[model samples]
Target: MVSLDLRRLRFLREFEERGTLGAVATALGYSPSTVSQQLALLEKDVGARLFEKAGRGLRLNDAGHLLAQHARVLLSAAEAAEADLAALGGDIRGTVRAGGLQSAARRLLVPAVARMMAEHPRVRVEVFELELEQALPGLRLGAVDLVIGDEYDGHPRPRPAGLRFTAALEEPIKVVLPAAHPLAGAGRPVPIARLRSDIWTASAEGTGHHAMVVGTCRALGGYEPDLRHRSNDADVQLELVRVGAAVALMPPLALPADDPAIAVRDLAEAALRRRLVTVTRETPPAPALTAFLRAVTDQARNS
Candidate 1:
């Protein structure tokens, strides 16, 4: 009989998701040596060679990939069973691990958590500020129960397999200029092409924000933006604009309702927007999970 340990199976799945033993260890709060030892034990139990040396690191072989597929199913089943048992108790009391982008985490998630805690005193929510790239993986790997992500115009998020996505809010992506800039008080929609010579600040490369800024500029502005700064934080980007250092493009959720230091303007292009979404696994939700999700959705609606 093949006696498989669920913990070892989890380590295997984590390694598959993370693609590095060090990444698995860091994410799970274990040491690399411990992950290696458990995976070795799993291979021994299954009586198969699951890994092969690829340069200086280990890579999963065919058998390993097959086993990892099974591992995901088994882990999901176990989680469903846990949820079922928790439901039998008829109490909305459990920890809901949530992840979100920085702006949504502050604007929506914080108030949602407060409301959930007040209504369901036994429910505890832990929040992690994560970008869409990090949030999706964490949701698939069972690290987070819910994710609040933003999709920019023309940079649609990939459809998450085995997950449910719900649209929360859609807001315009506005341009920010220094108050002293010539177009700062321009009452009409500012043409992007008009700012070709201005230095700009955008989120870091590879993020949707960066991609959208570069793509929009090229397609609409007819010139590449002179990007002088890169940051994922909205406050930092706004500060750069406030100091007359650079102009920025950002969603309204990321902008303060009242900031006199910077001028916010609509882009000449129509329907340039960002859509905020809620993502979760397709598994049956527990009472706590349902309640927490409702709280978040309510906050989004109110915002």
Candidate 2:
């Protein structure tokens, strides 16, 4: 008899994550008494203490830690097997949860979802409008099965511990300005170095793109821009520019759909490309997810 029951393993994982039995019970929709009894049964079968009291809460013992590690893998395998079985049937089918940046969701991801549904009626794809920072954590936690994320110039891409990534699109850095701004209709692209004194809004601090934009400006004979605004939201930053509030820089893919007051211009600075990445766990991408990513990438590339 295996001590590794799915229910017990799930309870242990939930307990470790929640830090209290009450929270675990709430999450699993079970009473505290039932949870305690099940854990006792699991411990008896394993012949080891699974946890020890730590202040007001329980912490996993060494044996529990060991078992917890395997539990994640086992849970993943079970899901993988189910996905495999679904693929074996005629149409690729299953629910796939993906997360990505706002523009990608608005511009690129919804189109992808429509195509996925048309191609496989049985498959369901869910998209979360998220920042890339949130997507990485979710992928690691097995919360999202895939992510459409972007990588910028300076920061290293996360090799999500046990995931593979591929390029979905390459985004170019662009200078966004109000239609009335002097740079809006320039026939030739302006060098970043020449725009030193332009009032500027920037991406939120600490992001790879944010750092790249600042670093590029400094390297190109530009000093720190007169900081007008800082935000992770590209559309908001662009709106600030659209109203002639300030000029902001962004990747072309992140531009808003329509703005009579706004115009996007390519930055001719060398090596200024950013990559959009499709991230998936090391466990093979279920066919439905694969089809969705591939179809979206192709559609986005062509259109």
Candidate 3:
């Protein structure tokens, strides 16, 4: 008779997602030794070696992989049952963990949180500020209940299994320059080639924004930009442009609708735009998470 402890199974699932005892410990707020001990106990109960050494860390073996799959189903069932039981008591509330990019958090997620708090006081929501690389994995692994991610025009991201994506908003990716720049008041779509000599600021390397900026310049403008500053924060990029240090490529949500210090212009290429999407698990969402999703989409659409 196998009576697997749900808590131990949770540690296994976290290990599968995070890839190490130390990481699982950090995420679950437990010590590394404690995680190791619990996992060892799980092996004893299952009567099989679930983990094998991979360099300095541990990885799931065939047996471990099989059980981890079962663990996922069991955990999801447990969570659904818990939510249903809570609902029967006239309380439809559960903590929803959400992750998003910096701009999405500022523009959509924070407003949605406020709406959720005011309307459904009992449903708690936690926000994690993460980029697409970090947020999507967390959502697929059940660490986050919802994610707000961005997509560029040419570089589409692969959707992981058991996740659903819904487009929420689309905004043009505009060229931002100092108000004093010669092309600031050009009164037309700014010719990207004209700005080839100007220094540029954009999101850090390996991000979609970096690729978009570099690719757009090379493909359309016919010259590589003198990229001087790198930052993921929209405000930092805009500040550099506002102070005449560097120009930037930014979407409308990244800055104030109208700022006198900076001039926003459409690129000569009309197809340059950013798409924001909400990503979630394919499973049926609990009542609170459903409401939170509604709040996020409504805020995104109305904003």
Q: What are the C-alpha RMSDs, in order, of all predicted structures?
A: 2.4, 5.0, 3.0
lDDT of each: 0.88, 0.76, 0.86
Each prediction's TM-score versus the true structure: 0.91, 0.78, 0.86
Error of 1 at 272 (Å): 0.4
- By TM-score, the better pick of 1 and 2 is 1
Q: Write the per-residue lDDT of candidate 1 for residues 1-303, one digit (tens) a residue.
A: 888888789889888877999988777767999989999999999999999999899999999999999998997898899789889999879989998888999999999989987899999899988887766756776778999988887899888578898999999989889889999885667889999999999988988899999998998988999998999888999999999999999998999999888899999866598999999999887788899889989888988
Judge candidate 1 against the unseen true structure and give its global Cα lDDT, from 0 to 1.
0.88
Per-residue CA lDDT of model 3 for 1-303, tens digit only, reads 887988788888878878999887766657999999999999999888999999988899999999999999997787678667766777668899988889999989999999998999999899978777666645655678998888888877788767898999998889899999999885578989989999999888888889889988998899989998999889999889989999988888888888899999888855688999889888778888889999999998897
**Alpha-carbon shift of residue 276 in model 2 (angstroms):** 0.3
List candidate 3 segments past 4 Å from native: 5-38, 53-59, 86-90
How do the residues 153-227 of candidate 2 rate in per-residue lDDT, one tens digit apiece?
A: 765586745678878888777777788877677546767766777778877776666777777788664587676
Span of 10 residues, lowest total lDDT, candidate 1 = 132-141
- Model 1, residue 259: displacement in angstroms? 1.3
Question: What residue runs in model 1 are displaced by over 4 Å at the alpha carbon?
Answer: 1-3, 14-34, 44-48, 54-57
